[model samples]
Each structure stands twice: as structure tokens, then as C-alpha cells.
Target: MTNKKKTTIKDIASVLNISAAAVSKALHNDSRISDKTKIAVRQVAKNLNYQPNHLASALRSGKSNLVGVIVPKTNSNFFSSVIENIEQVLNKEGYNIIITQSNESFKKECDSIDTLLFTQVDGIIASMANETTDLVYFKKIKKNGIPLILFDRGENNLNVDYVGIDDYASSSLIVEHLVNQGCKRIAHIGGYKRTRIFNNRIRGYVDALNKFNLPLDKELLIESSLTIEDGRAKMQQLLALKNKPDAVYVAGDYAALGAQQVLLENNIKIPQEIALVGFGNEPFTAMLTPSISSINQHSDEIGKKAAEAFLVHAKNSSFTQTLNKIILNAELIIRDSSNKKNQ
Candidate 1:
């Protein structure tokens, strides 16, 4: 069996009885080419199943027209939606995305950045890994003069464009809802304080408890990576306490799911024995036995804003000195787990 030769501009030129250069200009929609020739070139190119050489075009134009997107993980609906929106916005502007996942590993995140750079992407949009703390690797991106936009899990000290929700306000909203449900001894299963968003949530949780005149017990405030396993361990620790919390607010939905599993295994009634809530209104939160109350992060908006931020830099040759910090308000989604009235 013989491999078919890939169709080229020369093939279209031969079919249309025009110069290869004419075909090239027509394919690119160059102003020098006539409309009739351009239409003829496109029709023949389609017939031949011609594929444009993007790499060659990038080499000639000095712009790859490719964007890199790095996320901690892509399995969650929130990240998935964000990515979808980012692609949608970028695609309209004739740019494509190269996606990479860090799996919450700092080394892996660094590797992803390196790989994206190697690919000669026009810009990068990323959400930092949970294990990411060192800014040197992130600083490298800026050092290269590539546009870098961070969303959700980002470091402010890096001084780049960032798009995320008001995590502190979201946490306060969750606490207020729980307090309204008659929860006094509210516990928090939160992410690490080193992460900006988690730190904000922790601060909000503490302040909201104070605002409502509830006991701000140090024993009840525990920090972890906010993974499902972390949630299970933290929830177990909370359950073993002599004075158990009347409510538990987990910083992540996966962690909240783990906490709910532990509660079910122990035959503890949800909302009655202990109300439960989670962050990032994941779809599974509503599908649980007692639907988990959560905070909506507005992933679509974040994705769009992040992509737009990158475009702001991409369109302008001169970099903007002012950093874009888009902080959107999050909404509380009440469900059976935390809504005592509904329960």
C-alpha cells in the first residue's frame, strides 16, 4: 500500500492553472489576490483536502497563535467549564489552546510551564497547583515576556493578571447560611493557608463566626490540601472530638463528598446531627443523598476573563504595567445537607 502525498498549495495552483505564489496569497486571503482567484483557490483546496502548514505560518509571522492553559486537574466540572469557555473565547479570535494538567504537583506545574514555552505558545493562562509556593518558576514566565494570566489558584505576589471569585465573601456566605440553620459550633475543613484563596476563606470563616457570636474554636479549624482523602481524615478527626461541631464547612466539594461518606458510614443524620456544606458547586453535590450546600465559583466568567486578559496583552506590543485583578462575587447554593428548613 502506498501512502498518499499530502496536498499542497502547488497542487491547488496546478488545478486552477495559477502560480503557486498566487495560490498561497489566495489561501491567506491577501489583498493582492483577486476575489475570483481566492474563491477558486479555496474550492480546489477543499477538494484536495489541503491542510495549512501552521508551523511554517508561525515561523513567517513570528506568532504561533497558540495559548497554553495549565490547571491543577481537569476532572472537575468547574475546571472543565472554565477550559471550555476559554477555548470558546480564544477560538473566535483565531487562537488555539494547548492544555496541560499539573495534578497539584509543583514540579509537574513547572514542567508544564517549560513544555508550553518550548511549544512557542503566544501566551499562558494557568491555575497554580496546591503544592506551588515558590514564585521563581512562575517568575520565569514573566521573564520570557510572554503574557501570563492566572485564575482561581494564583499568587498575588507574582504581580500578574488574575481572575477569581471573592473567596472570603463566599466563605462568609456559607457561614452565615449555616448559622441561620442554627449551627453554633461550626467547624471548617479548609485548604492550606499558604494558598491565597484558602487563606481568605479561613479568615472569612473566623470573622463570620465572631460576627454571629459563635465559638471560634481553634480545634474546629483544620487545614489540609482540601483533597477527598484530606476531607475524610479531617472529618474523622472532627467526629472523634468530645464536643463535635454542629456544622462542617469544607473548602472543596470533593472533600465535602468525603466528609459526607464518613457521616453516612457512621449513621450520623445530615443537617440533624451535623449540617454540611462544600465550596465549588460541583454537580455531584446536588446528586448526593442529602445534597451538599455549596458556593458557585462562576467558572465560565473566570475562564472568559482570563482569556480576555491574555488577549489584552497579545493585541498590544507594549505590555501593560497595570495588572488585571478581576474578583467576582460568588453565590451560595443551598441544598439539603446544610438547609435545616429543607431537611
Candidate 2:
């Protein structure tokens, strides 16, 4: 097969025997260009298989209809759902999304930002990885007039646009729900490093226990990476303790699932003996034998809101700020795992 050269706007202009500027105006649907001319230009552009040069177009209009989206990991269900919603919003707005995953690596996250900068994306929407700390890279972008919006995982210091649920409040609600169910001795699992999300969750857990006059037992605290294996390992350790906790608050559903599997394998009864609560209402959370109680952060809504923020900021290139902070609400999903009678 003969490799054909990529068609450019100039090719469409030549095919139409018109000025490049006219073709550009038609592509942008400028009112100056009549509807008849716009149709003609579009038809020629399509026939030539012409694709506009985004960089040159950006240079001409001083705006790029490209948004960069960086997420910790594309493999997670929640992140995947968020990205899907974000893309839908941006697509409808006549914008393209440049997506990359950092895989929870700080260095990779930094590199991803660098690449987006080089691409000259009009705006950036990101969820920082677990290992990210120095947000100075993002700060420099905003300093240079690039719009940055953070959703999900974020840096507290950067005062750019951010949209997410109050982590501490949601965590408190979940822990309080478990405690209200008569879970006197409870344990927690799957807190990663020193990220604000996990830290706030820890605070919520501590605050809830203190409110209920439950002693913060050292044996009940199990910190592990949020993963299936880690959850299973932590759950095993919790089970081995001289005093096993009566209830567990897990950070992620996948880990919660792994822990549940261990409990079942040991013939431990759920809720009746050991109650459980989980975060991130992943698909499997509802499908399991005992539905998993979780804090619903509305992953898709987070993504859509993030995209909307990016678009709003992109429109106001001259310091036209839209929303500073949009804190969505999280719902506590009560399920069989946490409700004894429901089981």
C-alpha cells in the first residue's frame, strides 16, 4: 500500500481554489463566511481528508482546543468512568482531549505535565498520583497563563480550580454509619502514604471513634497499599490479632473484596460476626454475595465537573475565574456487608 501524505488545511484550500484564510474561517464557522461557502469548504476539506494543524490553528487564534487530562491510573473503574464523562463533555464542546496516566508515580506525573506543556494544551485537568507531592510544576503552568483544574487526588497548596467531595466528611459519614450499626471494635485498612485523601479519611476515622468514646486501639490500625493483595494481607494480620476487630472500614472496594474473600475462606460470617464498610462503589461492590457498603463520590460527575471547569477557565484566558472550589456531596451506601439484619 502506498503511504499517502497527511492532508493539511492548505490542501483543502488548494482543492477549493480559495485563500487559506477563507478555508480557516469556514472551518471555524466564522459569521463572515457565508453558509454556502462554509458547506463548500467543509466538503472540500472532507474530500481531501484534510485535518487542521492544531498548532498553527492555535497560533492563529491564540487558543488551542485541546485539553490535557492526567489521571493516576487508567485501569481503575472509578478513574475510567471519570475519564469517559470528561471526554464526553469536551467532545461536545469541540475540544480534543490528550490523556495520559501516571500509574501513581510522581516522576511520571511530572513528566506527563511536561509533555502536556510542550503540546500547548489550552487547559489541563488532572488527578495527581499517590506519590505526587511537588505541585510546583502545575503552579508554573498557571503562572504562564495555562488553566489547570484538579479533581480526585489533588495538591492542597495549589489554589487553582478543584472539584471533589469533602474527603473528611465522606469518610466520617462512612465510619459513623459502621459505628451506628453497633460496631464497637472496628478496624481500618488501605491508607496509602501521606496523600490528603487518605490523611483526611484517617482523621475522619479517628474523629468518629473519639465522638463515640471508642478508644483508638493501636492494634486496629492497619495501613497498606490500596490493592487486592495488600487488602488480603492486612485483613489476615487483623484476623491474627489477639483481639480481632468486629468491623472493618476499607479504603477501596477491590481491597475490601480481597479482605472479604479471606474472611469467607476462614469461615468467618459477615455482618453477623464481622461487619465491613468499603469506599469507592466499584461494580463488584454490588455484585458480591454481600453487597459492599461504600461512600459514593460520583466518579462520573467528578469528571464532568472537572471538564466543565477546564472549559470555563479556557474561555477566560485573561484571569476570568469560574469556580474556586466545588465540593460535591458523597452518599453513604448501606449494604448487606454492614447491615446485620439485611444479611
Candidate 3:
């Protein structure tokens, strides 16, 4: 079987007995081209099964209409929800997205950035990896003159557009609730201090403890990768202490689950013996045997705002000069793990 010739502007022009330029203008609905000519050209193009070369068109317009999104991981409900909302908003604006996951690896994040740049995306929206301390890779995105918007996991040092929840306030809320429950010796299983959000949460936790006139015990404050395995290790470390904490607050839901597993394995009662709280309000937080208390980061709102931030920069071309920061308040969802009063 022989290959069929692809239809082009000349093919439509030949059918209409018009110049190829006129056919091109008509297909694009240029104001100079008559509506009658446009109608005829479109009908002929459809009959010829003409498919527009979007890449060529995009090159001519200097816009791909494609955005790249990077996230640490997608298995978590929070990141997945954020991605869903980002796609919904961008699709409505005639833009498409390419999503990439870093799996919390810095090298993987750098590779994702390189891949997105290679694709010539109009803009990028990202949530940084746990190990992304160096901002050099992010600077490469800025040097390319494309808008970069970050969410959930970001650094102020990048000085680009960002949308996220008030992590500091969320931590404070957890401390206040635990304080009200008469937890004097509280422990914190938090993320690495290198990450901005986790640093803010650490600061908030420390200040909240001070505000309540509680002792700032260094042993109780452990910086981790925020993985479930690390959470179990940290929790075990806490349990080995002669003076164990009465309550524990974890920086992530998965880590909190790991801590819960350790507590249960040791026959320690939840909420009664050791209260617990986690951040990000993952669905499983409420599904466990002893439902975990967590902070609601408003994943949908964060996603929408992050997409909108990228749009603003893409339209205005001002991300290089004017930085946009949108921080939403977080809500604490009280549950069985931290509700000592009910227990």
C-alpha cells in the first residue's frame, strides 16, 4: 500500500482556486479575509482531512500553550488533588500540562526541570522535592525567561510566584490544641529545616511552646525526611527516652501513620497515653483505627491559586520583576488521635 499525501494549505488553495497565502489567512480567520472565503476554506479543509500543525503554529506565535508541573510525589492525596485542579484551570484557558514527579529526589527534580525545558513549555508550576536545597536548578528556569510558580514546597530565596498554606500557623494551631488538652511535654517529628515550610512549622512549634510556658526540649524536636520509615525511627527514639512526651505532632500524615504503627506495636494507647497530630489532612488520616488529627491545607484552593499565579505571570510577563505570594490559612481537623478531652 502506498502512503497518502498529507494535505497542506496549497491543497485547500488548489480546491478553492485561490492563493496559498489567502488560504492560510482564511484558515486562521484573519480579519482581512472575508467570512465567505473563511467558510469555504474551512469546509474544503475538513473535506481534505486537513490537520493543522500545532507545533509550527505555536513556533510562529512564540507560545506552546503547554505548561509543565513538577511535584515531589503523586501517591499522596494532596499532590494528586493539587494536580487535578491545576489541569482543570489550565485546560479552560486553552493550555495543556505535562506533569512530572521527583519522588523527593533532588537529582530527579533537576531532571524533570531539564525535561520540561526541553519540551519548550510556556510556564512551569512546581512543588519542590524534600532534598531540593540548592536553588540553582530553579534559577535555570528563571534564566530561560519562562514563568515559574511554586506551591506547597517552595523557598523564598527563589523569589518567584508561590501559593501555599500557612504552615507556621498550622503548627501553632496543633500546639494550642494539644496545650488545651493538658499536654505539657510535647514532641515534634518534623521535616528537614532546609525546607521553608518545615522551617516555618519548626519555628511555630518552638514559639508556641514558649507561649505556653513549656520547656523547649531539644531531644523531643527531631528533624527527619518525613518518610514513614523515618517517622517510626523517630517515634522509637522518643519512646526510648526516660521522660517520654505526652503528645506528638508530625509534619506529614504518612510519617504520623508510621508513628501510630510504632505506638500500637508497643501497646501504647493513642490520645490517652500519647496524643498525636499530623499535617496535610490526607484521607487515610481519618480512616485509621484511631483517626489522626491533621491540618487541612486546602489542596484544591492551593492548586487553583498556583495555576492562576502562573497565568498572571504568563499574561503579564512580570514574574521576573514582581513576585507573587499567596498564602492561605490552614484549618486543624480534630480527630481521635489528638482529642484527649474526648478520650
Q: Candidate 3 regions off by >4 Å?
A: 1-6, 20-28
Look at candidate 2 and give me any clashing residue pairs: none
List ranges where model 1 is wrong by over 4 Å. 14-17
Rank list by TM-score: 1, 3, 2
Candidate 1 CA-lDDT value: 0.92
Q: Which candidate number would show the highest TM-score if scored against the true structure?
A: 1
TM-scores for every predicted model:
0.95, 0.91, 0.93
Number of the candidate with higher TM-score, 2 or 3: 3
Task: Write one digit per residue (lDDT tens) for candidate 2, span 39-130.
Answer: 99988888887876777768978777888999988887899999999999999998989999998888998899899988888889999888
Pairing residues by index, what is the TM-score of model 2?
0.91
- Report the C-alpha lDDT of model 1 over 264-336, residue by residue, as the tens digit: 9999999999999999999999998999999999999999999999998999969853567899999999999
| Candidate 1 vs 3: which has more TM-score | 1
Worst 10 residues of 1 by lDDT: 317-326
For residues 1-343, what per-residue lDDT tens digits would candidate 3 score against the true structure? 6879888889999999999999989976799999999999999999999987778889988899999999999999999999999999999998999999999999999999999999999999999998888899999999999889989898577778889999888889999999998899999999999899999999999999999999999999999988899999999999999999999999999999999999999999999999999999999999998999999999999999999888887788554635678999999999999897776
Overall lDDT per candidate, in order of appearance = 0.92, 0.85, 0.93
